[model samples]
Target: MATAYISTPLGSAKLEGDENGLNTVTVLEQDEPESKIIPDVLIDAAYQLNEYFEGKRQNFDLLLNPEGTEFQKKVWSLLSEIPYGKTLSYLELSRRLGDVKAIRAVASANGKNPLWIIIPCHRVIGSDGSLTGYAGGLHRKKWLLNHESPSRQQSLF
Candidate 1:
């Protein structure tokens, strides 16, 4: 697997992938050195992520190959269908998955999402529109949501 680290507005991001596809994209809590030379296979992902942070890109078009169980993969796939600047509730996600009773399982699978922003696990919020669990921490989740918010706040100079 090829690995590359890049800097973002939130923090350092670690990307791993190869010829098959991108395996994961995660923001590291601890600071890590950015790669001076990104692997060829990961170059697109790195550049897209940089564009996302810079507000130049909204949709991702890189191949992904996240590792997970069948159910987790299903959940992640559904997450990717969520539109940019939109949020979905766990209950709604469960319903979409065809089993509202599987909310917990759905939430568990959402928590295990490996692609980070690319899969858009951050777009899943509480039924009450509250920001809930995020492996990258709620602060990062909030930042991501605000970054994707349709209404951008303008600053007066």
Candidate 2:
């Protein structure tokens, strides 16, 4: 596995992956030094992430190889399909997965998502539209959601 670190508005991010595909992109609570030499396999991932933070990119287009159970993978797969700037409730996600009764299971899998912004776990919210738990923390989740929010214009005086 190869590793690289990059700084974001929220915090420093650590990316881990190799030839098979990118595995994980995790944001750390504490700032870390950026990688001086990013691995070739992760170069694109780093670049794309930078573009995302810059608001120049909306969707990611790279091969991913996250490690998780079949159900978790399925949940992550659906997460990627959620359009940028949109949110989905946990119950809605469970319904899409064909089992409203699996809301907890769906949420568990969502919480376990390893790809961070790439898999878009931050897009999932509570049924009441509240920002819920995030592996990177709720603050970062709020930052991500706001970053992805469509630009709004204010009335000129």
Candidate 3:
């Protein structure tokens, strides 16, 4: 798999994929020295991600191939349909999957989402309107949500 790293507001993001499709986009602790130069395969993913971070793009259009179980794939598929700037509770996501009893499983798959902002697992939240779990840390999650919010903070004099 070809890998490319880009510095994001949250941290350094590692983009992994190849001819099959873009696989994963995970945040790192800090900006690390990139090992490989951006490959031809990863250019679009990098550009789209850069646009996303800049708030100039809200959606992504690229081939994706996230490795996961059948059930996990189903959960991730549904996650991609979630509109930008909108939040879905874990319980609601479970219900959408046709089994509220599977809340825990759904949340677990959401947590394991590999595509990061592209698939938008950060859009998932606690049922109690709280920022719950995130692989990239809660602070980053908050920043992402705020970034997508239509209610941009405007300075009025």
Candidate 2 per-residue C-alpha lDDT over 68-141 given as tens digits, one digit per residue, 9 for 90 to 100: 99999999999999999899999999999999999999989998998989999999998888989888888888
lDDT of 3: 0.89
TM-score of 3: 0.94
RMSD of 1: 2.7
TM match of model 1 to true structure: 0.96
Greater lDDT among 2 and 3 belongs to: 2
Compose the digit string of candidate 1's lDDT tens values, residues 1-157: 9999999888889999999999999889887999999999999999999899899999999999999999999999999999988999999999999999999999999988889899999999999988899999998888888888877683111
- For candidate 2, the 10 contiguous residues with the lowest summed lDDT are 148-157
Q: Which lDDT values do the candidates have, in the order given?
A: 0.92, 0.91, 0.89
The residue pairs found clashing in candidate 1 are none
Position 11, candidate 3: lDDT: 79
Q: What is the TM-score of each candidate against the true structure?
A: 0.96, 0.95, 0.94
At residue 144, give the lDDT of candidate 3: 85
Candidate 2 has what TM-score? 0.95
Tens digits of per-residue lDDT for model 3, 1-157? 9998988878789999999999999999878766456998899999998899888999999999999999999999999989998989999999999999999999899999999899999889988889998999988888888888888683110
Return the top candidate by TM-score.
1
